[model samples]
Target: MLSSIKRFLIGRPLKSAELGEQKLNKTKALAILSSDALSSVAYGPEQILIVLITVSAAAFWYSIPIAIGVLLLLTALILSYRQIIFAYPHGGGAYVVSKENLGINPGLIAGGSLLVDYILTVAVSVSAGTDAITSAFPFLHDYTVVIAIVFVLFITTLNLRGVTESASVLAYPVYLFVVALFILIGVGVYNIVTGQVSPALHTPVGTPVIGISLFLLLKAFASGSSALTGVEAISNAIPNFKDPAPNNAAKTLVAMGTLLAILFSGIVVLAYYYGVQPIGEVTVVSQIAEQTFGRNFMYYFVQGTTALILILAANTGYSAFPLLAVNLAKDKFIPRMFTVRGDRLGYSNGIIILGFASILLILAFEGQTEQLIPLYAVGVFIPFTLSQSGMMVKWIREKPPGWGTKLFINTTGAVISLTVTLMFFLTKFGQVWSILIFLPLIILIFHRIHKHYEAVGDQLRLTTCEPSIPVAGNVIIVPVAGITHVVEFSLNYAKSLNPHQIIAVYVPFEREEEEIFEEKWKKWQPDVRLVTLHSPYRSIIQPLTRFIDTVVHKASESDYQVTVIIPQFIPKKGWHNILHNQSSLMIRAYLLYRRNVIVTTVPYHLKK
Candidate 1:
């Protein structure tokens, strides 16, 4: 029944030959992998405004420059990752790149950082999406965490179904979001150019401006850089693309980068020109939507699509995290279970783990975007630094064609990424120190797993042994509670082995009971010897185990084999088994891990 349910939900398993059928074209790959970075236009501008406005209205003017800085950073990363795609076409994310170039310990750090970032991507994206819903309809404000968790589960199910299917399903929402934003940008820009102005709603720009400083500007820029979180996802999943996977992936990266730069810059421009400020409940994008197209269908359309794209943004993490986990597992840093593909050729275990982690973050923070935002950029930048630095090392060592230019570009990316990593650590230390704590623990776990795999390899290695000899004596011992059908079944099975000797042993709590059983067995004359042992303490497992040990020792001394056959009653119904004592289970448990000792079970099924 469970298999049937799994088949229905995730579909039947595809053959190995069907892998190409699951491969995505450039369009679908962009939709599946680019949603998270694109969705940042929804909240990325707002995060910047939230930080800058704390300083002053004058700082609001810096929004454009800060966004431009983020844009420049995005450009550098895109170029760096394009080189990464070509260099490691088998899908090289930060972990693989770092492991190959920077060594194993650094590689583990990159993997751990990416894992945390993926979880935060889901949590922050869902929380921000829920905020979009509550902004449109205030009634849902209380149920935000629950709604976010449901969205996580829903996306998880879609992904588990198949990558191509989920991408096709999610494409329209992304296009809608793009269309809606373009309309908002076009209308808002035209209004500003034609000298049209509308009264500010709720409050004006920065209300009471505070004193601005260099620290305040850096904080604002760091906040805006959240827009760059999902940029590496495309490079991480190059194998999922069609033939010429590297070229297709690189093209998609450029397209996604273009869209993000336009939407993010356009939104910041419109919000600034229209005097939009971060107000309670209402998002900057929503406020900009209202300004461009009033509270009409178009406004709701923009808001609805924004909420959708934000929620679907989790799909980017879903796509990348599983593949990253598979990479880590291949290196024995994580459990091998993550490397197993599901019926639909997706990494099912990684998808489910990502879902649960997101749910936990959402519940812990109560679906608050502000709280999640601080924890976001730290995880992202760690990998960015490692990936770019790794690429720098690769170019210097390989020195392939165009090596000089590539080396310079990657070095620049490394510097910028490392600078930003330290900046986030310094500015957001209070909110992000948990990640610092988690990295060491993850690396320790990786070492422990590596040690375990090495030990297993050593133990299971084959070695030459002497040839086998025939006609060795076999000794069989059966533990009997009473002369019942279960005992008879075990005795009959023992005789079939044609052993040199068979001993039926009974350990009894009382002398009177033992005598009665002996008399009955003698009358039956079953042609098997019966040995009675008395236990003063009435511990059935101990006496039975000692008897088997004595037999094994004597057999080993004579180059003979030993077998302990125990009989168990099988009930037709599960509940019926609880009515009987499980002595056979106890015997099996005791004999486990005993080298060269064989234990077998014979079952006698009882009629209901």
Candidate 2:
């Protein structure tokens, strides 16, 4: 069922050879590594407004402080994570840091938290962007599922082609976003400062009612502070950066962090000065954009640019989530499958899984950024806290002298991030933070369970002596329906065993048994015995399986050993492969459950 679901979500797996065909440069590196941080643009405003909705309306003014907080936090996170890149140039982000400094369980917590965050990142970013887009196009109002799937499928295809392919495709749009945001926010803020305000700016920005106390204010700050959720993707994707990984990673981190700060901070100021109300308003962003450049062309351009950049923010999850999964898998905290290179060598399976899960989230949460925000912040902040904690431990352990300079920065960042995390847990606990706790605990418990299972399996597993003469050479018993194919191969293998006796068993379904017997007699025969079993229901596996048990029982009673040869056909095409007998599949499963029966697949290829 899981396999079927994976197929439906990601399409078929491609050969590893295909994955070897792609590579990355600076331009492409930016795409994969910069996406998560870029995606922050979509919901940063919404998160700010959401927290302020219930508190005093003056909470909206806090958006500026929170935006500044994000910028400061983002800058610290980038520099610290740059140290992380230098410390461990390989990608894997928080999981790597925690695993190296702490342990596997801690690593699993980091990985699971990041994984959930990635999924929510895509869902929230896309949904928030879709909300903006839907305002402009009424037809998209209810087609969220369609839009989400299209986005997922398109991203999956781009990823399949390879990381470089998707990055290149996204580069221009990301650049466009950078320019558009810089321009829109810049012009809007300029207009506000210059007193060249539009008609919408004529209304009161919002009436400041001061009812919520300082505690509520701090909680609200924590809530709005989630704008920095994707800030750490740069660290995780450091390995994907171009050569001189430390340099490139630091440069990229600075670029992303600086740009994000400007955009987030500018938008906050522009909205504040221009009366861009976010809460209890219909199409707040569109209202602001339309108001900014009232001309049809410029207004449409601003709105379109904002909407596209927000939508593209999902590219972050698409690029980094898989890379993080790959790291966890390599560490053996997750399944080995996560570590295996996909056709694109890009952790393609993880990418596809995140894509679908995000879409499912979009559908389940109805694409509401407000609804998914709680689930989103919980996972992201856990890792942020753990990562910083781990890094602090590492820095302390290493006792690097220069670290004192940045100790205050890391110190403040870690404390602030941790405080926000505690606030987030306390604030969002009832809504959907339940998922965050459940998801990580599940991953933690699962890793523990898998370790237990592995230990037990290793204990129960028996080591066999390879090709040792077993007191006596076992009787080689093989069943065949045809001549000159698997039968020939089986006969040759039986000779290699040099068994006490070679027994060829045949199951005849029709009355032509007599004729078939004569034909078998005429065929090349080993210096052993041949037995034929009759099946009335035209069934192959069950009867053969039963006969094997009988032979094994007989051999044991007579103080002998036995081996079974299950013939397998080498199918050239997929359809022919399925049509061929599946007896081998069933018989292998059955025989492996018993004692002292060596079952083997004797493959025979069809002649061209």
Candidate 3:
């Protein structure tokens, strides 16, 4: 039944050969991977205003320059990652590039940074999406964290099913969001050009504007860089693309870049010219939507799409984080469990972990996007610097065709990213200091994991051939609750093991029960010795464990090994097992650490 439920939820297991069939084409791939980058415009434009509005209302116009700076950096990143796609076509992204070109520690830093960034991506996107919804319907504001958690769970479930399934589920809403933004941009641009735009409405803001400073401009630029968080996701997941994976991934990167540049730049222009303010209750993009489409169906439609695409943008993390975890795990930098694929060929452990981490962040922050946004940018630029620097090293060392131009491009990106990293540190370090702490802890964890794997390898290593010791005898003990077909079946399995001694042991609470079981055993004549132990406290584990210890002590004089085979029955439904008190579990637990004694469970599955 559990298997059936799992099959229904995530579909039947796919063969290893079927993985290629699961690869995504460019269009679906874009929708699945690009959602995070594309959906940033929902909050990216406003993040600038969030910082700028602190100085003064007049200082809000500085969003234009801040945005243009972000755009220039964005263009350089797009070009840099395009080079990454071609250079490390097998989905290297930052961590792989840095590890290959830079060094081990630098690679670990990149991996740790990207992993944290993906977690924040889910948290910030879902929280912002919830904020968008609450803005539309104020009544839901109280349940914001609950709503965000539910949304994260929903995305997690869809992704566990498979990447193609998730892409199909997410593609429509993302495209709908894209279409809606274009509509907002077109309508707003038309109104501006034809002189039909109305005067800006004044809304009371809870947070007031303050004095401006150079630090304020730097803070705004740093804040504006949140828009670039998901830009590397596509490059990280290039292996998920179909035939000509690198070329297709490069094209998808171009498509994502084009859409991000147009929509973000357009929103920035509209917000500035239309005189939108960073009102507390509503968003900057929402304000633009209100002005462009007014309080009509289209306005609400745009808001609805914004909420969906923002929530589904978490899909980008689901796609990339698991893949990154797999990469790290392969390098022995993390637990190898993450490398195992689930029934649908997705990295289920990594996906589930991402969801839970996001949920924790949501709960901790109470689903407030503003509180989470400051923690967002630091994770992003660390990888950006490492990856671009790695590429710069690659171009200079490899000296491929056009290597000089490529080197220049990556060098420029690395410098800009490093500069941003420093500026963000100087301007917003207090708000984002947790990243510094988190990165070091992650590096330590990677070192510990690598050490453990090395130790395990040493233990498992073999140097020379050794002579095998012959077994003098095999002792099999089957612990039974009664003389029934289950015990009979267990003895048959023990017989297959060719044991010289087969002891069917039973511990009876009452004397009459022992007499009855012995009587049945005598009549059955099961070709195995039956030993009965009396228990005053109705304890099954203690007496059985003592008997096993005696058997082990007797066998210690020879080369014989002791085996304890427990007879168990599995109920058809999972809950049915709870109704029975399992002595087998107790016996196994007690003997788990016993030396040279092997414990095996022979399960008799019940038809019902």
Candidate 4:
């Protein structure tokens, strides 16, 4: 029944041969990979205004220049990641690039930082999407966190179905959002040009609370840099593109960058002209829509598409996090389970884990977009710097065709990204200090995991000089609660092994029970030796294991193996099994890692 439900939700499993069909084309790929970057225009400008407006509404004018600075950084990243896409077509993004060129530690740092950013992307994007919904229908305001979590779960399910399926489902809304914003920008520009509405000339009524400084501008820039959070996703996901993966991925990256730049810049320009303020539940984009379309169909259309694209933005994280995790797993820096693809050829474990982590952040921050913004950009930029720096080193070492131009571009990107990272630390340290601690701790964890995998590999490695020898002899021990068909079945199975000896062992809490059991056992006349282990503490497993240990020690002289057969009764109903003691399970678990000790279970099925 559970399997049927799973099949229904996730669809029938795809064959390994169908994996090629799962790769996305350029059109669908842009929607899936660039939604996060494209959708940021909805709130990216607002974040800058949020920081700038603290000084006074007049200072909000600085948002345009700060946004341009962010744009320059975005341009650098897009070009740099294009180099990455072609250079490392297999696609590990910053982690692979940094590890190969920089070192192990830097690679781990890049991987860890990007992982955090991906999680934050899901949280922030969904929260902002929820905010959009509540903005349209304010009564849903109280359920913001609930709505955000529901969206996360929905996207997770979509991704679990497969990448191609998710892209197909998510593509429409992203395109709709782009078109709606473009319309809004066009209408606003026409209105300004034709004198339908004048440029915002009125200063805010409030007095300037604080004077503007270089620090203030830096703070705003850092906040707005969230626009660049998902730019590296395309490079990380080149493997997800169709044939000619590198070329297709690079083209998608360019398309994403172009759309992102136009949408982000247009929205900022319109907001400045319309005098949109980040003062209420209404977003800057929402305010611009209201001014241009005026609560009409186009207004709600923009709002609906904005809400959708923001929610779909999390699909970018879903797409990239698993790919990066698989890379880390291949390097043995994370669990091997992450490398295993599910029936859909998706990394189900990584996707599910990313969903849960994002849900946790949403809950922790109460699904407030601004509350999560401070924790957003730093994770992404650290990787940006490392990836760029790694590429710079690669160019200098390999000096491939056009290496100098590539080196210069990456060097500039590295410097800009590194500066942004520092700006985040300096300006928002009070809110984001935990990230400083988190990055190092995660790197330490990666090292520990790598070391553990190394130890496991060393132990499992085979050598040519090692001898292959079978066990000299076998002794079987069966633990019996009482004489029953279950015990008979276990004895028959043990006899089939034709071991050196077989013994039925029992431990009793009281003397009277032991005697009664012994008498019944003797009456049965099974012709097998019975070993009664007396337990003062009434612990069944301890006494039974000790007796087996004694047998094993005796058998060691003759090079005999000891096997413990456990008889289990299978209840007809799963719930009925809980009524019985699980001593068989406990015994098997305890003896699992013991050398030369084999544990087997013989089951007797019950009708009712």
Candidate 5:
């Protein structure tokens, strides 16, 4: 039943190693990866006014120039990352970048940043999409958190179901967003050029024109840079594409870049021509929609498309996180469980984890995408710097003299994006301090994980052949939890080991253990030996440890070895730590320290 439910939630998984380069076509991969950046057209302009609204309503006009500068930077970064595909076509993405030039720590920092960024991408994109919906229907306005959660769950369920299914579900809606924005902007532009354009349904907002300064201009540029948030998503997710991996990656990059540029510029122009003004906590698009279409079908249609597109953009993260987690797992930054595969052989566990984290984040932030927006961009830009930086290294290490043109292009992109990275690190430094807290925690997870891998790697590492120890009689001691079920299973396992002695060791740590265990195991038909070491302190682990040492000391003298049989009953459905506690851990630790003893486990898998 659990397997079936898992199947239903995650979908039929895809083959993990079966992802061939030529398998995924360029157009499909582009559509999937480009969703977030393309959907930025919906809210990138909105963010500009959101920031400046505190000072004056007139700051909305400045959104145009800010978006333009960001757009230019976006183009340069795209060209830079393009060089990345040409160089290291593996799924390395940002890690390839940082590792190549900046060293391993910086590579990990890039990894940490990108992982956080993908999570924020889901929260921000979905919340922003829903915000667009609230623009049209105020009835759904107060329920953004609920809506975002439901949306994340929905995507999670689909993603767990399978990648292709998730992509296919979101593909059309993303396409719809692109087409609608293109058509609306195209119509608006054509009307203006053909002299059929009229003033916006409302007057152009020029009143209270405040003098602009460089600080304000830099702020605006930073705000527009939000459009570049998902540019690195493609690089992370290129491994998921069909065959012709490099070609598909490059093609997807170009396609994403083109559509992103078009939708963004078009939205800016539409906002400007329509004189769309900003309302704090109100949507720029909705205000313009009401003004331009005034309850017409076109307004509703465009608004709906925009909202759906935003929600689907979360798919990009769904695709990338599982893939990135696989990389992290390989690096030992995450659990090998993340590297574990499902029926379809994909990293289903990682996908589900990513989905759950996104949902929690969406709810925690109250589904306010803009509130999470500042936290989002900084990490993504960091990876952008790393990826571009890595590509520069890739070029330099393998460069010929005639590669000047390529070097020049990639170098320029790295500098431009790295500069933006620094600005965001500073301009957003105070406001986005929360992410600083989160980044270290993630990095530490990576570190602990790396450290664990090193430790485990050392444990599993073999330098020479083990000294031949002649086989002799061994004691099969089963440590029961003093429960009815534990005793029954322990005896069965002890018999199976076929050891010299089959005994059930129950440490009477507590009075209850004495009473309950004495009454429980009083009648043993097969006469299984019950060893209860006294612990006046009522500590189970200490008594068990002392008992084990005594058994080994006696057994060694008798030309016999000890095989400690531990019966662990961990129900399929129970709080993990609460049940396992210190007993199981201490037992494992003690047994592992005694290499001569063969510690065996008898597990009772009960229903939830």
Candidate 6:
């Protein structure tokens, strides 16, 4: 029944050959990969205002300059990642680039940072989407965490269905969002140019609590840095594109960057012209829509699409996290299960893990986008810095064609990215200190996992020597609770193994029970020997295992093997099995790690 439900939800298993068909064209790829970067426009400008407004209402004027700073940084990152795509077309992103050019530790740091950032991307995007919904409806404000988690689950399901299907479903909303925002921006700009709306210059009404300084502007820039969080996703997911993957991915990156810049700049400009503030329960975009279109269909339409694209922005994380995890798994930095593709050819394990991790963050931060924003920029910028640094190193060492230009781009990106990272740490360290702890913890875990895999590989490695000799013979032991058809079935199966000897052992709790069982066994005979073990404390497993240990020790000394046959009876229904003690299961669990001990189960199905 569970398998049937799974088939219904994700569809039938896709053949391996169908994998190539799942690669996305550029249009669909944009929707899948660029949603996070694009959706940031919904809240990125607001984040800048949120930080600046703390000084005083007059400080809101700094938003434009800070936004420009973020945009410049975004341009540098986009160019750097394009170079990343051209160089590492196989698509490991920063992790692979850093590992190859820098070293293994730097590679793991890059991988770990990106992994955490991907998780936060889902959390922050979904939470911001929820904020949009709550802004429109108001009543949903109470269920913000629940709504965010449900969106995560929905996106996770779509991704598990496969890449092409998710892209098709998610692409329309992203494009719709772009159209809606452009209409809002175009009309808002028209209003400003027509002298309908004037610049919102606020005069000082009282003493400023905190005066505007360079530190404050840096804080605001770091807040808006969320705009660039998902820019690396395209480079991380080059393999997900159609044929000519790297070229297609790079072109899509440029397209996404262009749209993001236009939308982000337009919204920021409109916000300044209209004097939009981070009002309670209402978003900056929502306020802009209300100002431009009032509470009409266009207002609701803009809100609806903003909410949708923001939610679907999680698709960026869903698309890239699994691909990055696959790279780490290949290097034995993470578990091998992450590399396993599901029936739909998606990395199912990675997708599910990303979903749960996002839900956890949403719950931890109570689905408040403002609270989660502080932790968001650091994770992304760490990888951004590492990726750019890795590319810079690659150019210097390899000195490939056009290396100077590539080196300059990456160097600028790395410096700006590192500056932003440090700014986030210094300005928002109170809220973001946990990231400091988490980054190193994640890297340590990666090393531990890698070490374990190395140890396992060494142990399983084969040499050119001859194989060891086989055991002389088999000594089988069957543990019986009582004389019954189940015991008889196990004994007959043991005899078929042609063992040197077979012992039927029983554990009796009381003297009277032992005598009665012995008398019955003697009468039945059956040409087999029976040994009885008395348990003074009524411990069945201990006494039974003790007897088996003695037999195994003797057999091993004689160059023989020991096989324990556990006799079990199958009930007509699954619930019926719960009514009986599961001795067979217990025995199997206890003997699981015992070396040189073979265990098998013989089932006697009950007719009724």
Ranking by TM-score: 4, 6, 1, 3, 5, 2
Residue 482 in candidate 1, Cα distance off native in Å? 5.3
lDDT of 2 at 208: 57
Question: Per-residue lDDT of 1-608 in model 3, one digit per residue for the tens?
Answer: 77898888788888888898879999999999999999999998898987777666666667777888988899899999998988888885999999999999999999999998899999999998998998889899899999999999889989999989899889999999999999999988898889776544222333334576777877788888888889999888987999899999999999999999999999988887787888877988888998787889999999999999999999999999999999999999999999998889888999999999999999988988887877777788999999999998888888999999888888888888998788888877787898878799999999999999998887666752545546789998889888677777888999998888898898999999989989999888557899999998988888888888888888877888898998988888888978998877878888888887889999988888
Clashes of each: 0, 4, 1, 0, 15, 0
- Cα lDDT tens digits, model 4, 119-189, are 99999999999999999899999999999999999999999999999999999999999999989999988
**C-alpha RMSD of candidate 4:** 2.2
- Would you list the C-alpha lDDT of every candidate in the order shown? 0.87, 0.71, 0.88, 0.90, 0.74, 0.89
**What lDDT would candidate 5 get against the real structure?**
0.74
Q: Name the regions of candidate 5 deviating beyond 4 angstroms.
A: 9-22, 51-61, 194-210, 464-472, 479-542, 553-560, 566-597, 601-608
Superposed Cα deviation of residue 387, candidate 1 (Å): 0.6
Residues 382-484 of candidate 2 have per-residue lDDT tens digits of 7887787788888888878787755666666788788888887777777655765577676766577578667766666666333433445477778776676
Clashing pairs in 4: none
Q: By TM-score, how accurate is candidate 5?
A: 0.85
Give the Cα-based TM-score of candidate 1 against the true structure. Answer: 0.90
lDDT of 5 at 80: 71
Model 3 RMSD to the real structure?
A: 3.9
Provide the lowest-lDDT 10-residue window in model 4: 200-209
- What tens-digit string does per-residue lDDT give for candidate 6 at 1-608? 88999998899899999999999999999999999999999988988888877876677667777878888988998899998898899998999999998899889888998898899999999999999999999988889998899999999989999999999999999999999999999999999889888544433233244577888888888888878889999999999999899999999999999999999999988887777888868999999999899999999999999999999999999999999999999999999999999999999999999999999989988998888777887888888899899999999999998999999999999998898899888988898899878778988899999999998887666862546647999999898888799988999899998999988888898999989998898887557788999899988889888888888889988889999999999998888987988988998898877777899999999989
Error of 6 at 167 (Å): 1.0
- Model 3: lDDT equals 0.88
- Residue 177, candidate 2: Cα error in Å is 0.8
Candidate 1 or 4, higher lDDT? 4
- Model 5 agreement with the true structure over 529-595: per-residue lDDT tens digits: 7777668876777777677788888888887888877777776765664755647657877778775
State the lDDT at 438 in candidate 4.
91
Q: What is the lDDT of residue 213 in candidate 4?
A: 89
Output the better candidate (2/6) by lDDT: 6
